[model samples]
Target: MRRAIDWAFRDRRTGAITVAQWPNLPLWLFAGTSLADWILNPPGTVAWALRLIAGASLAWWAIDELLRGVNPWRRFLGAAALAGQALVLATAGP
Candidate 1:
């Protein structure tokens, strides 16, 4: 159990536990569009566009994390985030 835990969290090179890092490009895009969507409160079309962009960027980020994360915790976080987004979209009414 201890060995498994260490394997999941340890960085191969640095021997540090790495769960997350600074935001990457897709994350940045998601954040920017989310902020714009909240602050600007644009008209219907613009609002939809912002939401679409935000969702797409977030999805891209999630996929990248799932595929390339440095640690198991990071990969789990990505999976959870992706699932959460899917839930939101599923329940969001037209």
Candidate 2:
């Protein structure tokens, strides 16, 4: 059990357990755009643009992590995030 846990969560480069990491560039962009969308509440076109940018940034981050994450745990998080985003988009009103 412990070996399996380590196999999934251990950081390849650092050789330490890694469950979380600081926000990377795309994640930072996503946060900034999302915050702007929520707090500024711009008019229709600007709001839509912000939402698009935020979603693209999040998707880029997720894809990056899924393809090149340091550990299985990170990859799983990326896959889950992408799946969640897909679900939201699928169900969102036009």
Best by lDDT: 2
TM-score per candidate: 0.86, 0.91
Instruction: After superposing candidate 2 on the true structure, give the runs of residues whose Cα lies further than 4 Å from its correct spot.
Output: none
* TM-score of candidate 1 to 2 decimals: 0.86
RMSD of 1: 1.8
- Clash pairs of candidate 2? none
* Candidate 2 C-alpha lDDT tens digits along 1-80: 99999999999999999999999999999999999999999999999999999988999999999999999999998998
Q: Highest TM-score: which candidate?
A: 2
The worst-scoring run of ten residues by lDDT in candidate 1 lies at 11-20
